[model samples]
Structures are given as structure tokens and as C-alpha cells.
Target chain A: MSREVILGDIREIMADVFDMDVDDVVVTPDTTADDIEEWDSLSHIRLIVAVERRFKVKFTNAEIERLRRVGDLVALVEAKQPA
Target chain B: MLKSLSWLRPAPGDFRDQARALRSEMRGGRGDDLGMRLYALANHALDENQLVSLARLAAGACDAGAAPAPFSAVKLGVFGDGTLSLIAPAIAGTALRHRLAVDTFVGEFNRAALDALDPSGPVRSAGLDMALIVSDARVLGLDRPAASRAAADETVERAFGQVRRTVEGLRPSIGSAILVQTVAAPLEPLFGSYDRIEPGSPLSMTAAFNRRVADWAADGGVVLVDVAHLAECVGLEAWDDPGQWHAAKLGFAPSLLPVYADVVARAMAAVRGLSRKCLVLDLDNTLWGGVVGDDGLGGIVIGQGSATGEAHLAVQRMALALRARGVVLAVCSKNEEAAARAPFREHPDMLLREDHIAVFQANWTDKAANLRAIAETLNIGVDALVLLDDNPAERMQVRSELPLVGVPELPDDPALFPRMLAAAGYFEAVSVSKEDRARAEMYQANARRAAALSASADVGAYLASLEMACAIGPVSEMTRARVAQLVNKSNQFNLTTRRWSEGELAAAIRDPARHVAQVRLVDRFGDNGVIAVLIADKGPDAWAIDTWLMSCRVLGRRVEEACLAHLAGAARAAGARALIGRYIPSPRNAIVKDHYRNLGFALEDESGGATTWRLDLDRFVAPALEMTVADGFLAPENAAA
Candidate 1:
């Protein structure tokens, strides 16, 4: 999947899991902990779990924390996406 | 207690004339002399006449305004002699005004005015909001003469009875939300009574009265404020001057006001339906004494001996009480799972076992991170948490980082720990149903079931051999307590966590549109009393499963399938079309992650974890299982003739 597709999928999962609007999940590199009210350390893990299950890709805990923005999550997903 | 209204810059007469006109309007048919007499009484600093005038003015205002805003919030009516009078001013909100209408009338004449107000007239017509009858704290004063004791009790009961009658009569007008404060009897020998009684006494008669009031409100489907408990926690003496029953009527110390304000605020919150859902506890110093890591499980102080052990026992006891009151207890500790499991397994005196906790997070991580895992496991919101921990630093970290969670201050002294913990208001449930009492055991039983499933290759064969006996009964008087318990506490299995006390549950069972069934499952493990609840509203030739939740412990046993089959049979008998199942996702109930979908219900909608499923009753086949159907367990009311 492309970065946009991964970000879209991430946004859909975040919206569903956190009970937020899909539009609320802005795909930007600058997005961090301050970006989403629901995106805490725990939710970050859950988001990773959801993303891994959705995209069928896994990220390390260090990589998980480093993926601060929607773009970062998309990048991690793209990097790990099966060829 | 006298406040000269004349001291105001505008002069008292300016307001007096307006009050006189309102009084005249209220008593138009009566003679001017009578009106002037009432007016003079108001002018001569009579609170009774002034209250009459105020009531009339309020009635007139309501009569002139729009149906009094439909009192769309929880209302609390405060019927107290003086303590409530002090607390009322500190509370400001529509909920306060709607719920707590103070009767500032004084003396015998005040009672006469209240009595004289025609129940059929504008006083009732004004749609006076809910009432919380607060008993006079002075009645409980130890310094009161012996003769006054009986009189005080009589007075308190009489006042409560009068308010009860008024509320009973105003049921249709008020719409059934009356919270009465159980009067906390004044500590005897007011000046030195604080020292006379042992700390942490099983609440005074006043506290008991408040508890009864809470019971009454719960029974009446109204909100209850446990003032006695709240007051006792903050030190009753702190709110009042020594020897004086009522706090200084005017200009109360700011430090003292917050405690009273909190009581009122909590009361209003409950009345408005704002309550915490889960209590997330730290296991080490919080649940029991000594670290599980260093104590090696055997060294932990849980059962008896020193005050440390007793304190831990007390906390466990309190936690059990909380669970009984519908507060889901979850563990979020940084300890090895096996080490943590040891105490729950071996410690005989451990107040809380593994079963009492709905979810356990025993891992090595930041405490907040563990809490998050627990939240995810349970499928509940972080905001719905009351985090309890002994370490101030940990508590502060959670407090600052997770602003939504309620982090209570921990006491430095291990002895004062339980009392401090109880003051957090984590489990301020108005009523405890029978289902609540068995909750921890059921959850613990579920853990056993989980273990069994992990060991077994054939889950179906294991479920069949467990010899599960399901008894489906229509809710009746005997099962009312359990039914109400399920209604309030069954969040995960619950379609909607709509809480109803026993009385309300009984009433709902009688409603033609609504159908409620209690499911009791007993297997080789033990009797899990009425562990499942099904609530649905009847549609045109069909039933909508408003709520279908089974205790998580009963999950793998195919109990959900059995319950659905039973309900489908009932629907078919009732000549219904389809059985609609709803799966509303809560933060903690993810165990039922694919509940409706697994049950073969066609998905109608899936928005934000709120999923709806519909199954045609005709096509839906009950899974064949060799389970015993218990006879005579059917509710007597719902049993076929």
C-alpha cells in the first residue's frame, strides 16, 4: 500500500478506536503527543496493534514511539509492507 | 443567626414592598389585615413569612415562565434544619436549583405554612423539582438535654416523613427523582465529642439515616447523596464550630466550605448522573502492604498482625464494598504476574483475590502505561478511572499526564490509609444489588474457565462436559435484586449500561414495550447467580435486544449462544419476526469484541464500535448442547401456568 493508503487506513482505525472523526487524524510529520487528545502512550500501543493487524505489518516499540505523526505511522507501514 | 436585612445600602423596605405585593397577589381573597400581618411578619425578620413570599414569587415566576425548563437534570431537594442551609449557598447551578430547594421556613409557624399550602394548588402546580430531605444536625448533638433527644429524632423523622409524603404526592409533577439526605446525628458533647468516639466508627445514626435516605432515593429511582459518609471523611468538626451543631450560619471559613461544597457537588453530580465507572488500583501498598516484588509473596502483610496488615485488609474490604456497589475494580501494578498471583492464590486473609479484579495488568512498565493496558483489556475509557496508589509521585504522574483520571491523595500513615482511600468517592454507588456481591467470584471463575480453555483442545467438548445448567426466568420479586444488579453493573455484556435500581427494574419488567430476562448459569465450577441479563423493547412483531451481556467468566462456555436461543424461543412464542442484537463497545468490554457477529446476527451498522445485529428468529437455530435446563428456577411471575 502507498503512504496515502496507509495513512487513510491509520486514520480510519484511529477514528474507530478512539471514537474520533476521521478528519481529526491529520496526516502530518509535525503531529506529536500534543496532536490528539486520545493518542497517549497506551493508545499509541493500541494504534500500533490496530495498524499492524490492519496492514499486516509490525513495528518495534522504539519505532512505535518514534512514529509521532500520522506521516510517521504511514512511513513505518510503507517500510514494512509485504512486497 | 439573625441577619438584619435593614443593613443593606438600598434599605430593607425597598425589597419589603415588592415582597408585600407578591404576598398580596398570593392571598388576594384574604383580608388586607391578614396580608399586612403576613407582610409585617416578613418585615419583622420572620424567615417563615419571607419563605412563603419567596415560594409565591418562585411559583409566580414559574407560572409566568416556560414550564420551568422541564427540570431536564437530576434534582435534589435538601430538607435540613441548618447544615444544608449553610451548604446551599456554596452550590450554584441549574442542577442545584432544580434538585435542592431549601425550606428556609422556621419554627412551628413554618410547619403550619407548609401544611396549609394546598397540595392541589399552585405549590404543586409550580412543578417543584426533586427534594432531598436533610435532617437537622443539631438533633444529633450530644450536649442536647435528654428530653430533646427523643424530640430531635421525632422531629427529624417527622420532617423526613413530611417530605416523603410531599414527594410521594408530587411524584407525577416531579417525575420520580427525590434524594433525601440521611441525617447525621450530631456527635454528642459537641465540643469534645470528636475525641470521645473512636476514629472510623461505623457511621452515626445520622449517617445511617443518610444511608437509608440513599436507599429511599435509589428505590424511588432518584439520585442519593451520602452526606454522612462525605462529612465523616472530612471531619464533621471541620465543617462546624465546636459545640455548635450548625456551621457559623454566615461567613463560614473558606477552608471549611469546600468540603460541604464537594458533598453538594457530588450529590448534584449523582443526581445529574456523573459517576466514575472503574477504580484502577495499584496492588503493592495500595491493595496490600509490602511490595510483592521484594516480599516474595510470603512476606506480604495481607491478613493480620500489625496495623499494616489490618490496613491492607481494610482496603480490600473497602474494595469489595466498591465492587458490590458496581465499581469495576482493575489492577494496574508493576509486578511479575506470577508473584502477584501468589498472594491471591495462597494468602488466606487476602481481602481481595484475583476474582475481585475484572482486569489485571501485572507488567514492568510505567504505571500509566500499565493503566492503559488495563483500560484496553477492559474496553473502558481512561476518563472513567479512579486511580489509587500509595506513591504520591506515581499518583501525581498519572494525575498530570492523564487529566481525565481521578487520582486521590494517599495518606502517609498506613493506619489512616483505608479511611483516606475511602474518601476518594470511587465507589459512591447508591445501592448494591445481589449480582454485585457475586461479581468478583464470577470474574475469578472466568479466569479459571480461561485456564481450562487454554488447556483444552476441543472447546465445544469441554463446554458440553462442564454440565452448564441455564435457568431462564422472568424477573420477579425474588429475582428483582439480581436483575437490578445486572442492569447497573453488567457493562461489558450490557448492550447499554443503563442503570436501574431494583424498583425501577421491577417497573420496567411490567412495561409492555420492554422485556427483561434474568439468566443464571451453574456449571461444575459453582453457581453464578443470574450472571446474564437480556433487555429488549418489543417492536412490530419483533424484539430488539437493547442489552445482551453475560459475565466475561461465562464467555467460553457457550452461555451467550444458549441465552440467545432462549430469547429467540421466547420471541417466537410471542409471535415476533427477528431478534435484534446490539453491541455497543465500552472501553473495558472488548472481550465481547465480536459478540454479535459471532452469534450469526446480520450486521446493520458499525459506527464507532456501536454495532447492531439482527437475526431472523425463524432461521436462528439454538446451538445443540447437552446442558441441563434447571426446573423451578423460572421466576414465579414469568412461569407458564
Candidate 2:
């Protein structure tokens, strides 16, 4: 998926998981965990679970730890996509 | 007009004198006489108009001598019609009252109630400790049989809906609990209905009202007290009879007053998280008359045609009812296992069989030891047990040894045994779910599964043979109750002890901005109902998991691993790059302390008791499990995402 499509999907997932409005999710490349109240530590696992299920892919502990910002996440998904 | 006055004549002079003494005792001498005088005036009022007049008079009288404001307390708002005004003085005098309103429409009443308690609202909103809504049944027009029952139900629903919405909206603002009182209507025949209604029958209507009202209360996270149920149990007609209207004429019965007070008090306790979960019974004296060793299985007083036998039968029936409501029942006795098994096998009148009990400890051991063993066997904390024994010595032993277990003082009178047990407040659920009735059977089946697993060498082979299938989707209205049950009760695998009611869960699903999923697990063992719940919110290039918890019984079978893999795949398909996992450690969740670590997530940071972990979608691999996803289980939208 393209970066724009990836951002939209992430926004939808964040809205569904955090019980927040979709508009509340700002899919900026610089956005971090501090930007959302619902994006806590436990929710991190849930996000991983949702992402893996959506893309039919999985991540190692090291890769997951390195993903800190929206830009990083987009890069990881792009690299993982079937080419 | 005559309706209000007819309530005063039953109290004789002696009763009036006693009531005055009680009021004075409660008031601690200062303004006691003034309170009594005002109370008498209100009681003597002849009609609704007169009652309102006397209530206003009482309010003015109390306001004249109101105590100086305390430094730290939230001002509560009490709302009701005329009847509420009559009782306002009693609640206001003792409770911290910031403001009080006599009557308003349901919507406006709740708004004002919230405002009066809000810190930002007018009256310099102090924290509201509680809001008491005490309307009269006349307001709903239930006194007239010609009135539409449907309309009455709708009015009650609407009124409670407003109260619930207000409570929910204000919960985050005030951070205080809310309590509600049901309108008490006169017990009059509805024309074609039975002329003389039994105390138990009214519970049907009261239960209906309670269920309806609880829908809103649960949504708002408010606590509700069904005074009508308590009143019926203690005989409502006996006190509400036309003869005993006035406090000066017929005083409130001390016996009935305690029962009513106890209901409210217990409800308050439940609000503070002080409810018991287990019911422990002594086999010999409690379940039957004679010891099984002495009387033998055939001779023990458990079958029909005897008084003690009948009493034992009644206790069994009550136990079954308690078990049906999710109260775990266990035997903590000093009898041979064979002897205990014989009664359940041979007795015809036994209402509770071996299958009904989640744990059975009939070995020759200390009662306390037996209780601990039973708790461990059932996977529950010992503190949740409520021990009941006929022998005072045994009860005392358990009380002193295991202070955590609630030892209800059993009555000496055999006839009052059932009543006393009923009053001991066990199995009190805010609302019962379909899963509750099937809980004991499920536990029994789990026990069998445990045994089977113990006997088998290959755990994976055992799991594979069971043929487990998972049905995953967004929770609908029908499954909301089950979803809430899993969220509230499942502790071990739960990342966060986040408890949500049915209404709240429903609201979350209806909101478009969230992705909520519930996993239903069923295997050869049995249906685990909604065993797992996963709530997530979409963020920039990732879906954040809000809550991920599964029933502990379904653990060790790689179910959580399967669920995690499913969530990660779903998130990636939605174009999210990385998956995030979190661990919020609780006192009871140490078993899952390394869950994220085992799932191959790397810790990002740690704060307090919570730790954050993340996984990149590119490198993540789903754990292999011997399970199948039921066809057409995923929602089309979720599939697309």
C-alpha cells in the first residue's frame, strides 16, 4: 500500500482501538505515542496485533522496538509489503 | 388530599414517643426536637398539596438551624416530587447537601443535579458524593389501573435514561459515584389482577423496573438500589396499610427499617468494591441433620418426610439459585469423600448435585485448610469465600484463622436458617448474563479437561484433538453482555483491568472511530462464551491495542498467541506498519507478566507498573497453533481494513 493509504488505515485502526473519533487521529509522520491518550503501553501490543492481522505479516521484537514515529511505521510496512 | 393524611393515623402515642427518642438519639441533642416537630407536621399532612406545604415548612425550619459548612465535602443534589421533599430533611441533614430541588422534568432534573454537583457549575460545584432521586409512583401514574402500563414503562425508562446519561457525562468531571432510588407506589390491584398479591409477586414488576433502570445506570457507571425489592421481602402491605399513615400515630417498625437500611448500606458497600464471591457450606450440620458417619447415607436427614430434611432441601434449592447467579459453591467439611458422594447420588430431594459444586473438599482436614484447597481448586482467591456452618465453634475457627472469608452468623433457629442465608448478601450481580447460568457447568467441564490433560503426555496433541474454532468479529448488541462479562471478570490474561458495562460497550461500537473485536472460543470441552476481547484505536500508520484480555481457562492452548497473530495481521492489512503491545501489571496478573516478551515484542519504555512494547509488521511471524478460524467469522469491513 502507498503511504497515503497506509496513513488512512492507521487512522481507522487507531480510532477503532482507542474508542476515539477518527478525526482525532492525526497521521503526521512526526506524530508519536505522546500525541494520543489511548496509545499507552498495553495498546502498543494491540496495535501490533491489529497491524499483523491486517497485513498478514509479523514483526520481531527488535523491529517493533525501533518503530517510534509514524514515518518509521510507514517505512516498516512498505518494506514488508509483497513486492 | 386524603391519600397523604391516611398515612399518619396508625402510630399510637407510645410509637410516637419512641420515634421521638430515636430521632433525638440520631441528632445528638442539638435541634433534635425541631427535627421531630417538623417530621410530625409532614407526617400529619392530609394530601399531596398539604404534604408539599409541610415539606417546604420542614425545609425552611432545617435551613434556619443548618450546621456550618464543612471544609471538604461535595454538595449533593436530591431530586424528587412531593414525597422526596418529605424525606429531603433526613438525607440533607446527615449528608452534605450543596443544593436540593423539589421537582423537575427527568431531563432538566438530571442536568440541574449534575450542575449542582459540578465544580465548574454555579453554586461553586463541590464534589457530589451522591444524588438521590426519590420520586413518588403517582408521578408515573401507576396508581391508576386505567393508565397505560407501556407508557409507565416508557416514562420510567426515559427518566432513568436521563439519569444514566447525566451520570456518565459527569463521571469524568466530578469523579464521584451516583446512587438512585426507585419510586415507591402503593400496592393496589390493577383491576383484573389478583386482589391479594404475595410479597414475592411484586418482585416481578420491581425486577422489570430494576432491569430497565439498571440499563441506564450501568451505562453511566452509577449504582442503583431497588428499595421496592427489599420492601416486598419484608411485607410492604403490613406497613403501608391505610391505618398506619402518620409518624405520630404509627411509627416505623425497627425490624423493617433495618432491612431497608441494610439494602442501601450493602449497595453502598458494593459501590466500594466490597462484595463476596464464594459460598462455603459445612456438610454435616449445615447441609443435613446428622453426620454421614453417624447416621449413614440412608439415615441422614436429607430426603423427604422430615423437618430437618425439608430444611436441608430448602438450603440446597437456595444454593442452586445462588450458583445460577454465579456464586461459586464449595463444600468445606470433615467427612469421607465417599460419604459425601453417597448423599448426592442416593438422595432424591437433593437440589444440588456434585456437578453444581465448583469444588468439593469432603476430606478429613481442617475447615480452613479445606476452604483454601477449595479456593485453589476453583482458581479463585480465598478472600472471596463466604463460609456458612451451623456449629458456632467451626464458624469461630474459620473466622479467626481465615479472616478473609466472610463468616455469616448462622441462626440457631432452623426455621430462620433459609431467611438468614438469603439476607447474607451473596451472589449480588449488577446484572445477570446468560453465561452466569452456565458458569458452574463450564467450571465442572474445565475440571474434567484438566484431568484429561494431566493424563495425556502430548499437550499439543490434546489441544488439536479438541477441534477448537474461534469466531471473531466486532461485538454486536446481542453479544455486548458477554463482552462486558469477559472484560470485567477475566483477570489473569487481561492487560488492563478495564471494566465496561453493556451500554458503554455498545456506545463504543456505535462510534465510528474505533475498531473493537470479540473472540468467541469453542472446543470439544465446551463453549467458553466470549472468551477474548481486543479493543484498538487507529493512529498514524498503526492501530493501537487498547485492551487485550482472554479468559485464563483458555490459556496454555496457544489461544492468546493465535489471537495476537490475528490482530497483528489485521493491523498490517489496514496499512499499519508496526504492532504495539503493553503490559500493565496488577496484583493478580503476574502469570502474564512476560506475555509481551514471549510474544516477541521489544520493550520501548517502562513507567510505574506499565511497560510498552512494539513489533514491526515486516519481521513479525504468527505463532503456529492447532486451531481453525470459523468461516465467515470476520466482518467484511474488518476484512477490508
Candidate 3:
């Protein structure tokens, strides 16, 4: 799957978590925790769990901590996908 | 609890197809995994309304044609110190299995637990079945003075005193049960890790406090959840993020919420009395090493000498231990009845006997039919059964045939069987009542009654010939646990099946405005201990039956008639002008559709499927019971309701 496709799925998950439409989310490499209305500490954890379960991937604490934007999560998921 | 998750059956789908199929199901419906885990990824991420809707849709879709009312939600109150509000929604969402919905009351941040339990406390009227508390030195502001042993001791003692007082102050209304996490050891050093005296540390004091709480859990109303051990398991670095702690006062990191939710959900299930009641075992390779028919008694590997024999012996001993603690044991083997029972009777090393089994089916029939027959003979739903079989194919077949039967995966090695079964936690019991101790023998008596019924010409004559009698009275402490168990576990014969916890039952038994009784039946065969319970709300001139359920074993025996007669008399004696009963329709309780009408009660109202009936005390008379009554009997005319 392409990174855009993975990002689309992650956006859908984010939209569900925030109770918004998928199209309402506009993401870029710089879009981050402070940019989103619903992205808080607890929500960040839930988003990780949802994305990990969706992609059948596991993330390290360090990798999750390093993530600051949607692009970072998409890259981590793409890297962790089974080759 | 993995029911027909046929959607997840490794089909000819690629990874995307499988994921799409699962997502489609969740998008359009619920993904019922029988709560072994949360249904879908969306559940953890979505808010309460979305998650609960997905749960309900999935549950309705899973059980087709059986539109039972959505089960009542469990109410929980989370009262603690620190930033706990952020995690309440996650806990509530994670606990939503198909049959259970959890609603949480998150107390204000950093509120004291003792203050919450006060008379006008914020959580006083929540009426929670479970209350979760997270208290520690950091939450209580127990700062130390100049790093001395005396200061550490005083800090630990004060925190312990506060928590103990909070636990004592908690006046749990009726069904409320409290769960309190012990203090987590402070992993951080006061100043530096170097040259630290461990004995004078706060970590040592926290450990000391946890030990006392562990001892207190043995007799107190509070159940201790081992947060300190959980922190250790999660590892110190992941468990405590220094940045998050400093920023948000978070006790544990958000990443560990799933693990926390899993532990708490299981503890809640244990207290809610949702546990399996039967172990249906296949005799051939499951009980012994080889096929009973082909190998014969001596050839089977269940004797004292061989390693395989010892493995089989271990399984038998575990089954016997479970039976002793109220799990009914039965055998379903595909062989001649005599041939199957030969090892049980003849082998010197066999720990389980034919008497140990309440129902034994040894025929060439399919295993599913035999299991169904076993459940029917035992008068229980297939949901209450757990089957053990060594053969994977047989287990799969039974699973397909009866989705409700819990089939645990058995290891290839026979030696791992005992511990694997133990770790499954199938027979989790909150309290072992006196009636539970004699369950095995009582089932044996049931077998004799079955035999008597089969031999008699007519059912009524058989019932009359048995000289059966029942003793009904107020719920005493001796019978309170079993009464609550029956009220929770009984589904089919239950009219208005209401679940009451032991604390709730204890309170009801003492209230003069309420009427509660447990019925014990004794026949010529043996005594069936506390087979039924009935509760009613008593008013000035009217008494309404809140719940009435009888064991299915005595279903056709007119024991309910006798019970109603006794109720009418009691209502009249209490100056009640009328006795009323309600029949709320559920799929299982359809067997009791015309119960009140047949007993001469006039129909009062009917809405949707729920029906109410009333009996005027002036015209009602006690039904003439053939069996002698031991206690709680009124004279014939006194039973006027």
C-alpha cells in the first residue's frame, strides 16, 4: 500500500476518534499535536493503538515518542509493515 | 467466548480483503469477539456513543433470530486522586463486550476518596456496582522532610491511615463493590540514584503499605488490584514517563491503558458472577491416553507408572478439584456405555468415577448432540458449558455445532493440560457458598430422579410418589451467596430475572418492607440444596413479586404453584389486599409465558412483551400441595391472597 493510502486510513481513524468527517481533516508533514483540536495525550495513545491494530504493526515507545505529526505516524506504519 | 466469528475464518482473502471485511462488518455492525478482546480498533479510539452502538449492532447480528433485550449496563464509579478523568472513557469503552455495557462516573480531578464517600459526597448517589480508587503519596501530597527515616515512616503511616479511613468510610449501597489499587513504589530517588539508602526510602514504605492492603483485602470489602506489580511488569521507564508525570501529574503513561483496562475488566467480570458451570470431557484420549474401546482398561495410559499416565491423572485430579468447587463434570464419549465406564470403575489409577459425572453419554452419536443432551439433562444453557477434548478436529466440530460451548485450545503435550486449563480461568467464583460444596452430590441425586421419572407410568404420579417437600423462609447469611448466584445465573425459568449481589441480598433480607426467601427441596432420592429464590416488594396493602425463579430440575413438579400459594398467604398476613407479578419477556423465559394466568391471576396490563398480573387477596386460596411443607406454611384459610 502507498503512504497516501495508509494516511487516508489513519485519517479516517482520526476522524472517528474526533467525531468528524474524514474530509474535515487536512494533514501535512508539519501538521502536529498542537494543530488538531482533539489531539491530546490520551487521544494520542488511542490513535497509536488504533493505527497499530489497523496496520498489524507494533511501535516502540521511543518511536511513538518521536512522532510529532501525521507524516511521522504514516512513515512509522509504512516502515513497520511486513515486507 | 469466541463465538461464530465466521467473518474472521481464514478465507481466501488477501490481507487487505480480510481487513476490509472486518472493517466493513464494524462499519455496518458490531464485531463480537465474545469480549476475549475489544471488538475492533475503532472501539478503543471512538467515543462512548459510537463504540456502544457498534457493540449493540454486532451483538444483534451475532445472535440471529434471538432478539433478547440488550443486557443492562454495569454502572462504575472512578474516585481517586490525580489525573484519572482522562482514562475513564477509555476504561468504559474497553469494557464493552457484546452482553455488557459499562458506564462510568469519573469524579473530579484530585478529589479525596474519603470525601467522596461522605454523606453528601459527589459519588454517593451513583449506586455503582464497582468503585475504582487510585491513591498514592503523590496524590495525597505526602512530601517528606529533609530525607530522614522518621520522615519516610511518618509519610507512609499517614497515607495508610487516610486510605484505611476512606475504605472504612465507604458505605456501599446495596450492590456496590469497591476495588482499590495499592500504592505503587516510588521508583525515583529523592535527590540522586547514587549512595541511596534503600531502607529509608519512600519505595520501601510504599511496599510496606501494599503488604498491609493485601492482608486487608482478605477480610475487607475492598478488592486490591496490584498496580505496583503491574508497573513492574510494564517496566519502570514505560510505566513512569518523567516528562508526562511532571507535565500532567499522570500516575502511569497513557500507552499502558489497554493493559490496565484488561485487568480491571476481568476483575469486574469475576465480581459480576459471569463464569462457566460445566466441564464436558471426551473420554477417549482426553481422560485417558488411548481410545477406551480399542485399548481396553489396562491398555489405557492412566495408571501410576508411565509419564503419559501421570499426565492423564493430573487432568483427572484437576477435574475432580473443579467438581468439588461446584463445576458440574460430565462425560461425552463415542463408545458403548459399558465400555466407556469400564476404566472409571475398574482402573485403580482413575481419579474420576461415574458418580463424579452428573451426566454421562457413551454412544456412537455425534459429540454435539451428546453435549446438547448433557446440557438439557443438567437444565442449563449451552453457554454455561466448557468442553475439553484432545483432538483438534473434534473440538472444531463441537465449536461449529454449539457456538455457546466454550472450547479451550488444548496443547499437544498431555502434561501442559492442567496448567493451561487453570490459566483459562473458566470457573472464576466470587464466593464459595455452602450449597456449592454439595453440588456434585446433588447432581448425582438428580440422576436418580431422572431414572425414577423414566420408570414411572405418569409424570404426575412420579412426582407424587417421590414424596418431595420444600422449605421456604427468609434469606439467612448461610443461604445469601447461593441465593444471589441463583438470581444471577438462572435465566430460563426466571420471571423478571433480576441479578442481586450478596451485599444487595443481605440488605434486602434485613429490610422489613421487602420479602425474600430461598427454597430448598428434598426428595426421596436426596436433597437439592436451595434450588429457588423469590423476592418481593411489600407495601401497606399490596405486595409485588420482584423476582421468582425455580430450578429447571423441578420444573414440572408444581413447586411454583406451592410457592405462589405461600406468597399469597404471606401477602394476606402482611395486610396486602393484592399480590402482583410481572413477566418480562426474554427469548429464554418464553417457557414461563402463561405462568401467572394459569395460576388464576387476572391480567392487569400488557405492553410490548412485558405482562403484569394481579391476584385479589379475598378470592385467592392456597394451592393444595401434595408434598409436605417443612416451614413458611400458612393455614389453608390464611392463604387468602
Highest-DockQ candidate? 3
Write the residue-wise lDDT of candidate 3 on B1-641 in tens digits. Answer: 11111111222323223333554565664544523223323222233324423433434333333322333356777766656755566565545432345666776533445555566766676666677776755764443332666776666677777776665555453244677777656666665553145545666667666777777665435677777776775576667755556645667765566456545655665565456778998888778899878887778899688999899898999999999888899998889999999988988889998889999999989989999988888777776788888878887788778765767677778887876576445676555677777877777677777777889998778988889878777666656667877887677788887777667788887898899877888888788878788899998888999999988878887889878877888888788999999999864689888999999999999999999999998998776776876545343232211
Per-residue lDDT of model 1, residues B23-96, tens digit only: 46655543334322332222222222223333443333332322122122232334444444433433422122
Can you write out model 2's per-residue Cα lDDT over B516-567, one digit (the tens) per residue? 8888778887887878888877666877777889877687878877777778
Better model by lDDT: candidate 1 vs candidate 2: 2
**lDDT agreement of model 3 with the native:** 0.69
DockQ of each: 0.01, 0.01, 0.21
Which residue segments of model 2 deviate by more than 4 Å? A1-83, B1-119, B122-179, B186-224, B235-262, B265-277, B457-467, B585-591, B631-641
Question: Which pairs of residues clash in candidate 3, taking residues 3 or more apart in a chain or in different chains?
Answer: B30-B58
Best by lDDT: 3
Q: Every prediction's TM-score for the first chain?
A: 0.82, 0.92, 0.91
TM accuracy, model 2: 0.63
Estimated TM-score for each candidate: 0.56, 0.63, 0.75
**Shift of residue B417 alpha carbon in model 1, Å:** 2.0
Worst 10-residue stretch by lDDT in candidate 3 chain B? B1-10
